[model samples]
Target: MSPDADPRSAPTSPRPSGLWRTVAEIERHVATDGWGAPLRLFALVRTADALDRDPGLARRLPPNVLDEARADPDHLTSVEQEGVPAVADLDELLGQLAWPDGVDGAALVVERILVPPDAETEVRAVTAGDDEAGRARALAAHPLAEDVRIAVGVLRDGRHECAVRSRSKDSDGEVATGADLVPGLVGALAATLQD
Candidate 1:
């Protein structure tokens, strides 16, 4: 967490089922343009979401933290949300999530998963069985997530990051493809980043 942010101030309202939208957006741009643009958009939206969720942060986060988060990568250390350190780096890229490498459709492997970048930032989110868990789940059709109901914190680089990754236990935390519905998410991300 940034030194000057607050987590409790987050708005308590229904979350937007923006996965399909995000996915479609990303795919649309990538298929039409290039990866850099789509990824930039993804990062911007993702960074914005993270800030809104953690207001107590340093305020000058996006430009600074992103400098690290992008290259650092988010690693899924465990399917069990509580065990992971809040500031740990993700294990792989969304496409590298072997769990859903070949599955189909957006399915939440976990109820809701929270993805904390290695930069020690958290985007407190709620999973309604429809929310994508993280970048990986978003990429996979069956998304996973960890809402505020279950949260943990870890220390990395002397900073705190969100700790809690949700997966559909029933699905054994595997990823399914949402190629049909992903362009939205990807496209939106691309638009914001590509600029």
Candidate 2:
């Protein structure tokens, strides 16, 4: 599926579902560190399941967090993966990943430069003969290009959600949330959860 031309027009929810909440939380967490950050991957687990498997975690996690999990069966806890290697190709990186059985879902947060539909032809012409680095530079320098951080989450059961934060509209309230905001990334994350 193709992404929406204007991600800002995507749906937003005051009370998001479990997967949507997790994806939006990941996006906000990444935003705290500012831009130019590396790609981040997280394993989503049902909070109650995790606490049940290791009751000791109850002491480690905040009381409010534990309470919420107990109240909501769908609550999810995001466990970030560390020491991930930097890769030029996102698809290749995702292709190499396979989650363990305990992971109920997976999420990815990444930054990208987007050119508006009106500028697509000009963008293609500008970077036509350029190499990877040259093409990146050309796109970054494009006047109409936008910098956005996208968070996509997918469950083993096929549920998916996305949250997008454009640099220009940096506030948390302005974030756009929907299922198909980033269809390609959602598909990639789903692939990693395959058995």
Top candidate when judged by lDDT against the true structure: 2
TM-score of 1: 0.18
Where does candidate 2 stray beyond 4 Å? 1-15
Question: Residue by residue across 73-156, what tens digits does model 2's lDDT show?
Answer: 999999999988899999999999999999999998999999887676676676657566877777788898899999999999
lDDT of 1 by residue, 57-159 (tens): 4355545465543443331111111222222222222233222221111211112234435211222232334444463444333223333111111112211
List the pairs of residues colliding in candidate 2: none
Can you tell me which runs of candidate 1 are displaced by over 4 Å?
1-16, 34-48, 51-195
| Model 1: lowest-lDDT 10 consecutive positions | 101-110
Model 2 alpha-carbon miss at residue 154, Å? 0.9
Error of 1 at 68 (Å): 27
